[model samples]
Target chain A: MIDIKNKIKEYLTKKDTKFNSIFEINKMSGGSSNEIWIIKYLDNNTENKIVFRRHYSRISEKENLYPPLSLSIESEVMAVAYKQKIPVPKIIYNVDKDHELGESFFMEFIDGITLGNKIVENRSVKLLKPNLASQCGEILGKIHSIPYQNIKDLNTSTGIDEMRKYKNIYQDYSLNIPVFNLSFKWLEKNIPPVTNKCLVHGDYRNGNIVVSSSIGIKSILDWELLHLGDRHEDLAWICVNSWRFGKIKLPVGGFGLRNDFYNAYEQSSKKKLNKESLKFWEILGTLKWGIMCLKMYDAYKSGYDRSVDRAAIGRRSSETEIDLLRLIDNEDRYE
Target chain B: MNNPPSKEELITSVIEFIENDIIDELVGQKRFHAHVAKNSLQIILRQLKLEEKNNRFEKNRLKEILKMDKDLNELNKILCQKIDYEEIDINNNDLIDHLFKTTMEKLSIDQPNYSAYLDEKTN
Candidate 1:
């Protein structure tokens, strides 16, 4: 504990001379990979709330396949997305890794349901359920339409490159998961042409968004995996069965049908949606998530982060195994 | 031998204690971890009851698919190499069937309530 309160106080006072005192600093339930804290402070006798998010430097390069986006770059991307009228948190100020506060930034806090299980199944949020899928499709369209040139240091690894990358990681694990091998084989044979490459929110799914019952989606969270890839990667990633959170039949993040989602996306993006490419990316996304789960298990076995949550996530790889089988065995149905 | 509380009973008691006594008393990340701990114990209980039969079925399937008698892990390793080297047809129905059944077995031990597993089970 680096005395986060005092550090924040120093930063705030320097940024704005009128900074009076800190009121409260509450740690929020953030992504497993980062730390999020909601800070309330008074500047000139007026109270304000902002969210502080920081990347955990403790995550060794050996433990993660791709390092998360630097906070400076993330701040830039958030600014770009905000300009494009996308639902993203407004960046307040960003500091580099060399800062005593580490690689972290403060942003406006948009409150809503960020839990996957609750957004999909909670009765209290039932009012937003009907339009959730379309809203997601529209947001994804907006995300994909952002020009990639402005973003700096974003890797533009297309589907084939990503497949090889993940394959290398899986092989490094030295675990003989035949389903993963078969899925790789399937992906190789059915790799789609990269027709469009744009800004891809690499982990856009149910849990990554803040959803309000009144306005539907308030803001999209977790841009650490930001990259440039096939537009369908964002579209298909949300449809992956693992993200569905037990509502398998309703494939659009377990909220609505694919048609509604696709129509809304097409309308917003003004680009034709290819069902075949979407199916291919969906399979790849499932495999990627499965490999990620195994990575979690590897972390546990190697005593990296021995939390029960990481250990439990390791068992989830099997869920994706069965999902991969279903997608391959019954391609017609899933597509 | 431990007569009063067997391994399964002891695990069940711990799970009960965590779920009924410990979980609700906690909040935020601690509560989340407590739930994860409870689920982990439940998975152990399921594996204790199901692993032997599941492994037997999986081994038999792998043997049929690869036409070899070997330990489960060894057979799986060979199958993986075959797929990797393109020695075996990727779309072979036997391979597909075997993978599906083996995955289902693993899911039963891991997360039986997972939607994909539940969908297949109901189907």
Candidate 2:
């Protein structure tokens, strides 16, 4: 095996940094898309430890394993989140050059457990049941509250014609999944004009948020999908049935009530989440998730990562379809 | 009354067998097997359960709105190729509700713990 310790030292030295002679590197678990290593540099003099993340591979090239562009997005989003005052790991260094560190950036590794699959398995998180939804809303509100002008260069804006943009993206992957096509058709037919555009975390849900067992939501992770669009997109995504895991009642990542989530968001943002607007976004959320599930399946079938999680995610397409149905049913009842 | 087993029934039987017999025996990363079995079953069931009805309903609704032939399968095939959802008319809310409800019903059965969750939500 290549001496990762010496390799890291050489790499860091080239970047003009000095740390402990010995580096302790341990691979962090989860994430089908990219390889995460928890590298702790023990300072011999100060006896202190500093951590940095290194990409396992490059984005343009295909790796036998690991996700593409995940590190690049992670590094970029971490920087953006830091600027927005959203709780996230601090970005210390970013190396995208293929010749340098092979992959991408490095950052101050935040200390918290990602509430991804563990949210469904961990019984301990039940204690935070009452406040979890509210906390999620607060964090999301903070994310959406980011100024649009600051990140204009990122091309995050959805533009004036939101419906047209959504239709194009939905159409791109609607072929294999017909139900989503129909849902998109429905959303198009009932185009609720966008009132305001704000910073939207395109993929905000349980899997991305990091929380301490005792401290609640420590930070929100994963901002690759961050863009400027209808603010309600994030809200609808959190409540989407597929994200609820197996716990359907607690719509907010299956941890808290929908009413509570909406109330909390309203309280935090001082903005009303119109039921009509929310319903439309919820349908869009279901369609988005359903298509995403199909994409994972397509990737796997086409000889991409054949991980168990990707397969499981593929099955969730049906769950999102079911949510789409329920949302339509609820809309019918109200109408 | 001797028709062959429907595709839906065959898929359901296969899923049941996997869930009951094959799942436990096929160790080592059984999660993927479970997922494949469940989704394969769902796709087949959805085709059997909703394909005909959705096609007919969507066709009639489209015909009413666009003043075209009520050939839904043809319309749907064309719709599938086209990427825009706004092209479809939404004059008849009732038809939209029916199509939406049917899709949801098909999906609800496929959820891992949907029944228990529904019971809790309803209560």
Candidate 3:
């Protein structure tokens, strides 16, 4: 178990939280890019629970895991987003080397299904589907409203910079994929001029959202990719088909219409959205996901995280290729 | 080696074991990984059964489009290079059709149930 419990004790003492002992430590698994565990401890005869996430030792620094961000930065971003009233898991503490734990942190555990299919298909959650689009827009408006100068150490970028960064990663792999190259050609030519740069929740999608039957979007998790970028990146990523969970017709996270989502954003943020830029970002988001799939495949082939799931995910790059083709060619569903 | 238990026979038996026995026995997160493994094996089985036919079809299409003869992998590499350098116009009807057909064939092996694939296939 890597004696994670002992490390937790040290962390509690360092933060002056006054830990009694660990009640239980249960490992959690989802679309996790880190080692996540639910640690229940008793403090002054009272029970408490927190989610502890840390970098796994097996993870290589050399790995082309998406643009790397330190866990401290991730924690800070979470704090900033929470302060801005953006629905997020409240970060409790950032574990540093002084605590003798690897890069890790303590966070409030929000109970809800972040699984896309569960949110789409489950009868309990499906009742809240109609309200989800506007809720997403409202949360995104607040997240983007966080003044850019407040969050420290954020990489500022436009849509073109993102495209080039991802393209460079593709080239570094020395991987020549014709379809992806075609996407690069198209996105390079269509880079929109940036009218606004704000705090972008780089991975705001259906699967990243936490939902309950009564309270929709309890939290938006996974802030490791937080950056300053085109507002449309967050706007278009939710509409990506993979996040829609087989509801191809329902564009906004498989919950509502694009117009409804856009209207909700305008109502909340008072910013007019660019339809052309939105389309460009949708294409770019699809391309980025496709390339990430290829990277996972490479990780498996190179014997790095040799999980069977990674191998299956590698095959899934084709899904993004199809999405790109549909978007780029203006091919409507079933046509 | 000529064997009585063919590749398909071995694959079928293993798949049957996973589907009938293992799936029923497994639960929780392990069950999800089990499903993924089974699906991957099934994809391998399909590739084994279809590679000969698909490769021949793919190579023939490339030959027609590129106006030269080459192996399937080599032809694909060249096509990628052509697309990379803009040597071949991307809007060419043959190129689009070929790319679409290629991606669909891959999804048939990789994820046949993908919604986009189902929609494109039926159309």
lDDT of 3 at A46: 79
Segments in model 1 whose C-alpha atoms lie over 4 Å from true places:
A17-19, A42-47, A96-98, A123-130, A332-335
TM-score of chain A of 2: 0.77
TM-score of 2: 0.69
The per-model lDDT (C-alpha) reads 0.86, 0.62, 0.81
In angstroms and one decimal each, the interface RMSD of every candidate reads: 0.7, 4.5, 1.1
- Which of candidates 1 and 2 is the stronger one according to TM-score? 1
What tens digits encode model 3's per-residue C-alpha lDDT throughout A1-335? 46777777666766664555666878777333566878887877878788887766466655645545678888887887788778889998778745567777899988888788888776665566457888888888888887668557888878878898788878877765678888888887787867878888889999888998787889998887788888999999999888889988788887767776788888888899987798899989998888788787777888886887877887888899888887888843421
Instruction: Note the clash tally of each candidate.
Output: 0, 3, 0
Estimate candidate 3's alpha-carbon lDDT, on a 0 to 1 scale. Answer: 0.81
Cα lDDT for residue A179, candidate 2: 57
lDDT by residue for model 1 over A147-202, one digit each (tens)?
76866787787989889989999989899999999999989989896686888888
Ordered from best to worst lDDT, the candidate numbers read: 1, 3, 2
lDDT of 3 at A272: 90
Arrange candidates, best TM-score first.
1, 3, 2
Q: How do the predictions measure up, each by TM-score?
A: 0.94, 0.69, 0.92
Model 3 misplaced stretches (Cα beyond 4 Å)? A13-18, A30-33, A42-48, A331-335
